[model samples]
Structure formats: structure tokens, C-alpha cells
Target chain A: MNDTFKKLFSPIQAEEALKDRTKEFLAEKTQRYIGVRVGKRKHCLYAAVCACLLLMLLGGRWVYFTPITAISIDINPSIEMGINRFGQVVSVDGFNEEGRELSSTLNVKYKNYTYAIEQILNDNNIAALLSENEIMTITVIGPDGQQSAKILSGVEACMTERGNAYCYFATSEEVAAAHESGLSCGKYRAFLELRLLDPDITPEMVRDMTMREIRELIDSLSDGGQIDTSSFDNRGNGHHGHGGGHGNRRRNGRAEQ
Target chain B: MRSEQETIRAIEQYSDTVRRLCAVHLKNDADTEDIFQTVFLKYVLSSVSFESDEHEKAWLIRVTINACKDLLKNFSRSHTVSLDTIIEQPSRLPEDYRDVWEAVFSLPQKYRDVVYLHYFEDYTAPQISRIIGKNVNTVYTLLNRSKQMLREKLGGGYEYE
Candidate 1:
């Protein structure tokens, strides 16, 4: 019975056409096996490209908004402008009450640093002070890098037309110490000189004093002698001369070198 | 999913055995083709690790039988084969082989799997019990009854034991 049954079933074979059809069905169902792999790879590539673009956008925003140099303008209103790598003023901060009022009136945020300084000098109140010979000081404070030198040069060029304006570069350490005493960079330099002469002056005494008042105090304390201008100009690499003689200020572009 | 090479190799090796199991349970070529697709496609997608060639063959047989039974359970589709197709199938065989084939298929569905696995495939009752998911003693009864039926149909001239 077993031999007979084997012979009976032996003749039954699946035809080539049936096997071929079934293979075609499986191939269709499984996406030819390669399509799935290629699809997954394409998805991964798109995700990678999107991540790269997002990182670049975030990095670009950081680089554009971060300040590399600060320009402190002190006449009576002591205001500081933060300058980015591209020379744009990204921030405006006032060190005194009058400085805050002046900063609020000037629409200089996001403008080029040179343009912002020109705007401040051209402000009606500031222009009136300059005409009256109220000593105005413009200080560039940052690391002693090429960017700082470039900023100082730009500031010097901007101030060449004004006789009493002084443009000096100071180190970040000097400026940080100045901020601790609640003074702008220019006022801080004057305070350091005043401290040497009086040794009893406090930051509060000169906190609201005009730059002209501070300069007059320095000149008086020096006993009509040549005040050592070294303290005023920390980085003496560029533009280091003093506008001497308070009353003899006709056109002593003495600080223009 | 399995790779293409592995699936094709499995198709080439087990397609014949699957067809025979389909023949034992199904009535026509369309149903047989369904069993083939279902069984082989399952093999491709399944991650089962086979111990040997025989293990793979038994797995295919079990899947094919289940596929055939599921197709038959669908009452919406016709369960009967046409007389013409039935006649056409046996006409290709020699007279003695044709008689045996007819006698085997004429048995009930429950007896056909046991008779095919025991007599043709030479599986012991325990192996058939494991493959078909039946009790061993039940498989023994089925094999005995199927042999008696085949002998009665083909006439008591051969040793069916």
C-alpha cells in the first residue's frame, strides 16, 4: 500500500508556470526587496540634510548677534554701544540717567557702529555741548585684536573733524573694572586719574558729573602741569595725544595722531 | 523579510512537496495555487530557524495543509471541483496509478492527511500527529481507518498493513 501510494502521488508535480507565478507574487508583495532598502536610505539622507541646515541657521544667528567690541561715548550722558563682528551696533546701554535718556532718543541700534557714533555726535543736545567746548570722549574697548584696532581707526576717522573729542582704545579688563564702578570707559579713565591726584574721590561723586567737569577737575588737580596721559590711553598703539589746556582749546587736535 | 536568494531557494526545494499536500486537501488547480502562494510567502516572511532539511519540509507540509483547510472553510466560494477538471486530472495517469489516486482522494478529509503522510511519505503516527496537531492514538485510528477504506475501494488484493 505504501509503494502504491508513493507511485500514485509521485506523478503530481507543481508546474514551472505555477512556481514562476508565485515568485512574481512574492516579488510584488515585498517591493522587489531592494526598494525598501533604497527608500530607507533616502529618508535618512533627507533627515541628515535637514539637521545640517538647522545647525547652520542657529550658528549663523549666534555669530550675527554676539558682540565682539564695545564703543563707549561719554560727554555728560555716558552710553555704550555693543558692536558685532560686522561693525553693526547690536546693543545700546546707558551707564547713567542722562545716558539712558540719550540712548532712548537716538535710533542707532542695528546701524553700523560708525554711523551710530555720527548720529550721537550730531544729536542736538550733544552738538550744543560740543560747540560750548564740553570735552567729549569716545573710547573703543575690546580685546587687543585686529578687530579692536580696526574699530579704533574707524572711530578716529569719525572724530577728526571735532577738535575736543578724544578717541582712545582700552582693554576689556580695564572696561570690566570700569563697569564695576558704574562708570563708562571714558569716565572711568578720568576717575583713575582723579584718584591718583585726590586719592579721596569716589565713583558716586563723579557718577553724574559731565565729562567737561571731570576733565576740569583733572586739570586743576595736576596744578596746571602736564597730566600724564598714559592712564587715559591704555592701548597706546593708535591715536594717543591729549587735547591740552582747557581754555586754550581753539583746534588743538592734539589727540589726532 | 527574508532575502530574495533565500526565498527562491526555498521555493525550488519545497514547492513539489507543498503541491502534493495541496492535492491531498484541495479539489482544483486554483485552490492549489492559493496554497502554494500562501505557504511559500509565509516561508519567506517567517524567521523560523530549521534544524535540518526534513524539519523545513515538515513545516511546509503543515502550512500547506492549514492553508488548504482555510480556503475550504470559506462558504462563499464553491467547494466542488467540475467533473471535467476531475476527469482531466486522472486521465494523465496510468490505469493502476489512477485507481489508487482516486481511492486515496475518495476518503474523507481527516483520513487523507494521515494516509498521505503514513503510506506515501513514510512518517510514523507520532510524526504525523505532531505535523497535523492531532493526538498520536487518534492518528493511529485515522491511519487504520484510511487503510481499510483504501483497501475496500481498490479491492482487497494488496497488503495495506
Candidate 2:
């Protein structure tokens, strides 16, 4: 067996073949994520529109208005309609019941957090609707507890499925007016009557959760029961045997570097 | 700001070198490919800009080694393939060189990676050290230990000189 091994083992072009296979594998994997390009372009369009509106609204007063506008934009715009779930407004490609034009955009806000909504828009798949005349209905639930509704025109759409708070924005006449009045900018927007779909749990929360926790949560959901937490040590000192700790340390070290 | 196509081309150009480095360290095709893809993907996502081809190449090697270590951790029974199985697959290498290649493949993954980088990839100790994120002294020691292991595995038949 030893002699056979020695005889079979040689330095031929195995290295080159291995290299070629590696390249092919990488090429194939990269192509899967490359489709994000189209999404990115759409996001750029949304961002451009938002920036344009923001610029117009703040016109000649951008530097002075930016901070105030930033603060006024609500942190969490989502309404948790149920336990561990929330709702968001999505614009689908269809006509309203009245046959009047319908358009949509996501309205997401998460408490005590802010994200670059424009970047999020560019990362996901969103369809554009036709119809020169369309309107989006926004109902603002003010922080001080007053509710107001308005019709928004020239609305663009985007989506978000994760977070303790919603992360969405729109650029419409109503939204602009709300910002101008500075009364409705950061207020909650309810879409219950519009019958929008529930917002997806934010990726940030899922990402923040430990792998084991997520696995357990998924398992519990699958089995329809409370998860077993006895195995989970609050100190995070569970005996992972070999490799786990070392690997985590190395990964964390690299991330820090 | 560089286009994705430009980035892909640059990565493709160094694919072979990166693979060889990974193969040497991993001593098997499966692990090597995993490391190779990971390294390239990381490069694509990173905001760091490279000054030149040399800098890019160095970065690729470094990232490849780091990725290899990462794979070693998550490497479950399901993911690991025997080095013997990888060697037995008849593909490109000629029969005469098969012995040397097999011997290299049989070396422990750590030693194999260091030797491949130093000898096959033509990297000096300092460069290998940087790529592997180890000290220069450590790299030299690893190379020496790896050469001893290779010589022992090759037995009396092959001559390095």
C-alpha cells in the first residue's frame, strides 16, 4: 500500500488542474450575487429622487436643514401587528379597486436607529409600476399621539423585511409637506386600511442573534413549541471542545485588524 | 470605484497563484477551492484600495491563508474529503511527477501550505509570514519542519538537489 501510494503520487499538472477548478467554482458562485446589479441601479434611481426632493425642499439651506430633517425623520416607522413581527407597505404592480392609479413605497422606522435607506433600496429586488397618474396614501401617527392621513403623488417603492424598527422612506408631495411643516416628518405612518403586507423581520436582528440562537428559533418555529434554553449559558462559556474558540478568536482578530 | 468586471479580471489573473497557495496549505482540492473563493469574495467586498499588482497579489495570498484557517474551523465531517481521494482522481498530472505531488499532498496541511508558498509560489520567508499572518521566525521554523516531513515522506527515492 505504501509503495502504491508513493508510485501514484507525483507532481504532475495536478496543481494547475486544481487551480482551474477553483477558478470555475469562484466564477459560478460570484455570478449568483452579480444579479444584485439590477437592484443596485433601481436603488440609485430612488436615491437620486429622494436627494433631489431633499435638495429642493432645503434649497439654499441644505447645511442648516440637514440636521433638523435628520432628527425629524422617525427612527422606527413600523407597527408591530403581532408578536415578533411587523408590517410594511409595498407597491405591487396592480390597479386599485376604484381603477384610479396606485403607487407604493416602503415606510420603515426602527427606534433609536438609523440606516442609509438608499443603500438598502439598491440591495434588493423591487418592481416599478407604470401609470403616469398614481397616489400613495400615508397616515401619520404623531409621536405625541395625533393621527393624520394624506395622499402622496409620484411615489416610488422599496422593501425591508427586518428590524425592531422599520427602515423606509418616500419622496412625495405629502411627505415633503410633512417635512416642511416639521410636524409629521418623524411621526408614525399607519397603512392598515391600505392592507399592505407585514414587514419582514430586519436582517440586522437576525444577524445580531447568535447562530445557535437563530438555529434554535428556527427549530422551535418548525416544531411549534418554546425553545429549550437550558443548554444556553448566559456567560457564553459552553464547552465547544476544540477549534470553535480558536477559530472565533482568529476571525474576530481579523475583523478587528 | 473600480467596476466589478475590472475587479473580476484582476482576481481571475491571480486565481492560479491563489489556488496553489491554498492547495499547498490545505493539501486537498475541496479545502483549497473553499479558501480560494472566500479570499476573492472578501477582496470584492473590502473597501481597501490596492496601489499595484504586487500589493494586490500580496493581499490575495494573505486573505487566502486567513480564509484557509477559517475553513479549518467550520470543517465538519460532511465537508472534509480525504487527501487520498483527492490524489487518486486521475486528471492532469503525468505518472512520473505523481509521486512528488502525492507526497506533497500527504504532508500535514500546515507544513504543506508553508512549503508550497515558499518553493512553488516562490515566496520568501518574510512574504510567506505576511501572507500567513505569522512572524518571520515562525515561517522559517514552519518551512524547516515541513521540509523535514516531506523528506521523510519521500523516503530514499527522490532527490531535492
**Winner by TM-score:** 1
Error of 1 at A44 (Å): 3.8
Q: Could you list the iRMS of every candidate?
A: 1.7, 7.5
Q: Report clashes for each candidate as comma-separated counts.
A: 0, 27
Please state every model's RMSD to the true fold in angstroms: 9.9, 30.8
Worst 10 residues of 2 chain B by lDDT: B88-97
Deviation of model 1 at B63, angstroms: 19
Model 2: per-residue lDDT, tens digit, A18-97? 44554465555556445346557879999999999888778745432222112121212211110001122221111211
Candidate 2 deviant stretches above 4 angstroms: A1-257, B1-4, B25-35, B78-84, B89-91, B156-161
Candidate 1: true interface contacts recovered: 0.68
Error of 1 at B160 (Å): 34
DockQ for each of the predicted structures, in order? 0.43, 0.08
Give lDDT tens digits, candidate 1, residues A156-193: 88887886788777888989999999999989988897
